[model samples]
Target chain A: MIEHYLSLSVLLFCLGVLGVISRRNVFVVFMSIELMLNAANLGFVAVARLHQSMDGHVLALMVMAVAAAEAALALAVVILLHKHKGNLDTNIFSLLKG
Target chain B: MFDVMVILPLAATGAGAILIMLVAAFETFRREGISILGMGLFAFAFFIQLTVDNSGDIYPFAEVFNGMLVANTFTKVAGLIILACGFFSALAAQTYFTQNKGFVLEFYCMLLFAAFGMLLLTMVAELITLFIALEIMSLAVYTLVGYDRHSVVRAEAVLKYLMLGAFAGAFYVMGAVLVYAGTGSTSFAAIGAVVADSGYLSNPALVGGSFLILFAFLFKAAAFPFHAWVIDVYDGAPLPVTAFMATAVKTSIFAVLANFLLINPEVHQGWVTFLFYLSILTMFAGNLIAIGQQNLKRMLAASGIVHTGYLLIALVALGSERFSGGAILFYLAAYGVATLGLFVALSYLSGQDERRVSFDDFRGLAKVRPYSAACIAIFLLSMAGIPPTAGFMGKFYIIAGAFQAGHAVLAVLGIVSSILSLWYYLRLIIVMYFREPEQRFEVAELTLAPLGTIVLAVCVFAISFYPVVL
Candidate 1:
């Protein structure tokens, strides 16, 4: 059962990474990052079960809080970019190429 | 008394931030007071940290926090650097907004929050704790980067930074999960024991997990390959913020890196070779990038990459057997003072919307305001590692430590890179003195910035002789 869950978690993480790199829309990219984090949370829970401890559950909760914080900040940046250029395209925002 | 004293600085800043937020609700509180208040609170906390920090005391409260936070001498020292950076940055921001328009009280609040996060980062002893602290710091910084909502350039910088930062952050969480799976524990002490006993290379899960975490740190520290983002973000942010990020943020990150490396010799040994080549490449690439830049802020940003390279060398040469955090801390202190001073200087002189840009803009600056030019020259010289300045002493300690650890080739390469850096560093000085005045150099009230610059110039020398403070 633990191995089954862990395999699914790995698949979800790979998909998240793929979505972030292949997508151009800022919203999609951010959502992809959240997906990646959730996948890690799933892995944590699986491992916690294998180890027969509550550590994984605690870690998942902690990661959820952090993911929410990241989402709030990402939304603020999205709004700021929209206000500046009326678009949410990542490629369009390259004014400083450092 | 000891517990109360140790936690006082953190409590004060937290309370001050809340008070400022409440004040921002009023119609006429004015942002200037918030800046002053922030600076005062930081300075007060810094002094309190100085007096209260007693190494290895392990306040009961800190332990009760479940080993997540460890307020030792090292953490206290990093906190002092962060708070002082905050205090001086507020000084620069105060002078800056007199010309520019974004004077919201929330800006100062964010700065305080970032400092709070940095303090936590330096003290974090658990992986989950470190990740949370890191997010707090990065989130506040992203907001500060785009505070100028009107500038498309600023908005773009924030977007790229946020996207990449979030991406790296996910990598960090994944890394932590893998490590937890491998070791059945998340604390540094447990991980260290496992790595030490089992050998770092043999633990596939921990090994792979560490690489991911290290990649994220390198990206944050602006090391080679992951370094391309730094220039644009620094360019888009206001001058004062650029300075704050360069000094305070880097210092905090390096502090955390040094701690992680100190965990076990075998663990670090596994990564040393990659770190060695990476440091050399980082230095040369940074110099190449910096040489091609004409804009002063972009040039400074590129130089920051080179400085990170030198710090990486310090990491490479770090003795795995010992837990000496001295070299890292001293170098960070020196870098913070000089870099913060330069940005503070730019904040005052860049004048209303930052009309200055190219190297030629500063030509013949000595003729107009010799003191400002001299202060800037001192900062540049310090950065180039000239004698009797903080930058020089910083380079000396790192190089000396590297040589002692039998990494002679890296030390020599480090010196060579330091020499290469002089080209860009001295270019500003030559422009300031050699060329005839091309543009009329303007000055403002000369209040906080000039004061900050002069003080940092003296600090360049004082930090070289840090034993005095010790």
Candidate 2:
């Protein structure tokens, strides 16, 4: 059961990584990052069960809180980006090429 | 009592941030007053940090917080550097806003919040605490970068930084979970104990987990493979904000990196080979990029990357040394003084809305404003590692430390990279002194940034004399 859970977590994490790298839309990229973080949350839960401790659960919750704050900021940035460039594509926001 | 003293600087910065927030809500407190308040708060924190006296073995508030945070001499000095960076950047911002039009009262509020997060970062000894501190600093800085939302460049810079920053944060959480799986604990002490009990390289989970963590740190610190975001982000941010990011943010990140690396000699030894190659690549890569840059801010940002490489060399040496992070901290102080001095000068000289941002824009500045040009020349020379300046001394110590650790190749490469860096740093100096004065350099009379620049220029030389522990 632990192996199954860990495998699923890894699968989700890989998918998220692919999405962040392959996708062009800014929204998709952010969603991909969220997917990656939640995948980590799943790993923490599974690991907590393996360790027979609640530390992983607590950390997962803290990560969720931080992820939420990050989502709020990401949305604000999206709106700001749209106001300037009128597009959601990350490639379009290329005034600073570094 | 020691706990209170240990927590005083963090408390002061946090309280100051809140105080600024509350005061900003009222219409009576003006903009200049708020900048002064922020400076005062940073000064207050600096003094408290100075007097705390962490030279002894007293962990101060170690047990009170369950060792989640520790304040040693290393942390105290890093704290002082962060606070001083805050103070001077606030001074720069005061003058920056006076000439430029975007005057939001809450800018100081955010600056203090960033400082608050950095102060916490310096003391955190636990993984969760480090994550929280990292986010607090990143979030505040993201906001500060895009504060002037009307510009397309600023918007673009913030987006790039935010996306990459959040991605890095997720990587950190994933690594933390893996490490927890390996050791069943998230504390540094617990991990170090585990590494000691069953060596760092022996455990697969610990090995993978630490690599991921180092990747996140290197990304944040703008090291070799992860440094592409720095030039654009630093170029897009406002002058004073860039100054703050260049100095305070780097200091806090290096402090945390040193803290984590110092966990165990075994841990350091495990990654020395990878770190060695990365440091050398980072130095040459940075110099190559900086040499091609035409913009002054971008050049400084690229040089900032080279400085990160030098700091990496210090980290590779950190394993063999027992001076306990003293060398890294000394190099950080020296680098900070010169970088901050250059930015403070840029804040005032960059003119209204920062129109003069390129090397060509600063042609023959010495002919019109001799003092400002000389200050800039001193900063540029210091950055290029010329003698009798702090940059030279900082590079000297890092090379010496690396050589003492038997990493002679790394030390020689560092010197070569600094020599490459000289081409760009000197290019700006020559551009200022040699060319004919075309554009009239008009600076505001009541600005505080010039005063701040002069102080930092003095600090560039003054900091070199302060002897390092080893």
Candidate 3:
């Protein structure tokens, strides 16, 4: 059962990586990052069950809180981006390219 | 009681940050007053950190805090360097806002907050605590980067940093989870015990988890392959913020990384081969990028990558019996002073809206602002590892440590990269001295950055005399 959950978590993490790489939309990339964090949370919870300890559960909660903080910051950045360029595409924000 | 003393500096910085935030909200103080406050807070923190007698690894409130924070000579020096970087950056920002527009009241608050996070980062002994500290620093820096919403360039820079930073954060979290799964503990000491009980390579989960965690660290440190965003971000960030990020942030990250690696000799051995190759690639790649840059900021950003490569060499040499962490700490301090000095000098000389950012912009600077030009030259020479400067002594210690650790090839390659770095560092000096002045390097009246630059210039030479055993 733990292996099954771990496999699901890995699958979700892989999907998130794929989304970050393939998607061009800024929002999608951020969502993909959130998905990655969730995958880690899933892994933590499953691993906690396997180890029969509460450490992983606590780690998951901590990760969730960090994820929320990142989300709040990401949303503000998205709004900042929207205000500047009037678009949500990552490719559009290339003024800083070397 | 000793533990409380060890933790006092961290507490002071955090409290100072909150105080600044509250003060900023009231809108009572103007920019100059707040800048002075920020600098004062950093100086206070630096003194507090210096007073702490961290002779050995002292895990503060170990039983009560579950050994989440540790202080030692290494962390103490690193914290001192971080606070000093903050102080100089605040000084630079004071001069910067006098010339340029977009002075926010909350700027000092974010600076304090970032320093607070970096202080926490250096002390973190647990993966979860490390992650939180990393975010706290990252979020504050992100705010500092994008504070000027009116500038489209800043917006673009912030977006790139944000997206990539969040992605890296996710990698770190997943990595922590995997490490937790493998070792069943998040504490460094516990993980070291597990690696000691069972060989590091034999455990597949530990290997993979460490790799992912290292990925996050390397990304933050702007090592090779993960260094693409730094040039752009540093180029776009305000000068003082760039200085802070370049010095304080790197100091903390390397401190934590050294701590993480020192958890066990086996772990360090496991990563040594990887770090060796990465350091080589990072140096040459940075040289290649820096050689083509017309703008001074972009060039400095690239050189930062090269400096990272040098620090990575120090990392590769770490964990040997004879070679202590003094070399790494010394190099960080030397590099921090020189780099921060350059940025502080640039803050004033950049003129209105940063019109003088390119190498060509500084033609004959020695003729007009000879003191400033000389200070910048000192910084550049120090960075290039010229003899009698801190950077030279730092390079000497690191390379000697590398050779002493039986990694002579890395040491030689580091020397070669240092030589290559001169191609760019000297170009600025030549431009500043040889050519005729195009425009007067008029700086704003009563600015402190010039004074900061001179102090750092003296430090570049002074720090060399502080010997580090290899």
Candidate 4:
């Protein structure tokens, strides 16, 4: 039973990673990161159930709070990028080539 | 009371950040006032950190905080470096704002906040606390990176940093969850106990989780594979912000990485082979990138990656029976001083709107401003690991530690990397001294940055004499 939930969590994480890599839209990429974070939250909840402790549950909450903070910052960055370049695509903002 | 004493510096920095935020709202305090306030707060925190008695590892308020934070000589020294970096970066920012266009009142507040996060990052002993501290530092740094929202370059830098940073944060959370699943606890002590009782490789979840955690750390430290973001990001950031990120952020990340790896001898053992190769790749990659760069800031950013590689060598040699992190701390201090010195000098010398950023722009700087050029030469030579400087001693200690740990190959490679690094370091010196003057290299005012540069140049020599017990 635990393995099934763990498998689901890993699948969601992989999907999030795929979204981040394949998607070019900044908003879509950020949503993909949020997806990855929520996947981790799912893993934490499942692992807490397996361990029969509240530690995982509390950590999951903390991860959610941090994710929220990151999302807020990400949105602000998106708006900043949009204001500067007048678009939301990642490819357009290639001023500094890495 | 003892716990409060142990955490006094942390409290000071956090309170200082809030104080700055509130003070920024007032009408009387302008840019100069807030700059002084920021510098004062960092100095205050540095003194507090210096006064804290750190004889051994003390878990402050262990019962109440559940062993989430640990304080020892290692964290103490790292905290001191972070605060000092903040102090000098604030100095650089003051001068940087004088000629540069985008001067925000909240700049110092963000610096204080970032320092506070770094202080917390160094001391965290649990995964969740570490994650929160990491985010706090990252978020503040993101704001500092793009606070001047008008610039397209700043926007691009912040976008790259935030996206990658959030991705790494997710990896860290997942790793923490897996580790908690395997060990049934989040504390380092508990995890180490479990690893000790049952061999590290016997637990699949623990191995996988630790690998992921290491991945996130390497990304933050700007090691080989994840180093692509650093040059662009550092180039786009404001001079002082770049200085802060290069020195302070790297210091805190390495501190936490060392702490995490030292959870158990077995854990360190499992990762040693991997870190060895990664360190080697990071050095050469950094050198190659740095050799090809014409922009001074980009070159410094690549050299920062090479320094990270050297610290990784120290990390690989860590966890020996007599390990005390003396080498790592000493090397960080040396690197921080030189890097901060260069950036501070650049802050004033880059001129209005940072027009004089390329190597060609600085042709024959020594002819015009001999003192500034000499100071920059000292910093560059120190970074290149020349004799009679802190960088030399720092490289000596790390390589010596590697040799003592029986990793003679790593030691030799470190020497070779330093040799390769000199190629770029010397290019700057040649540009400064050997060429004919093209421009006056004038400054509007004498300012605090040049004074800070001299202090740091003196410190580059002064810090070498401080003994490392390794």
Q: How many residue pairs clash in each candidate?
A: 0, 0, 0, 0
Tens digits of per-residue lDDT for model 3, B298-372: 999999999999999999999887887889999999999999999999999999998899999999999999999
- Estimate every model's Cα lDDT from 0 to 1: 0.84, 0.88, 0.92, 0.93
Candidate 1 C-alpha lDDT tens digits along B173-255? 88888888888888777788888889866777888788888888989999998999899989988877888899889988988
Query: How many Å off is the CA of B201 in candidate 2?
Result: 3.4
Q: Please, what are the lDDT tens digits per residue for candidate 2 over residues B295-385?
A: 9899999999999999999999986855458878988898888888888888888888888999999999999999999999998888889
What is the lDDT for B263 in model 1?
69
Candidate 2 runs further than 4 Å off: B56-65
For model 2, report DockQ. Answer: 0.82
**Runs off by more than 4 Å, candidate 1:** B1-4, B57-63, B320-323, B468-470
iRMS, candidate 4, in Å: value is 0.9
Superposition error at B87 for model 2 (Å)? 1.1
Q: What would you estimate as the lDDT of candidate 1? A: 0.84
- The pairs that clash in candidate 1 are none
Model 3 Cα displacement at B149 (Å)? 0.6
Report the candidate with higher DockQ, 1 versus 2. 2
Q: Write the per-residue lDDT of candidate 2 for residues A1-98, one digit (tens) a residue.
A: 98788778878988988999999999999999999999999999999999998778988898899999999999999999888878998877767885
Encode model 4's per-residue lDDT on B1-470: one tens digit a residue: 88899889999999999998999999999999999999999999999999999879899859997888999999999999999999999999999999998888999999999999999999999988898899899999999999997888888999999999888888888788788878999998899888889977889988888888888998999999999999999999999999999999999999998987887887788789999999999999999999999999999999999999999999998988675688899999999999999999999999999989999999999999999999999999999999999999999999988998999999999999999999999999998889999899888685899999999999999999999998
Q: Candidate 3: misplaced stretches above 4 Å?
A: none
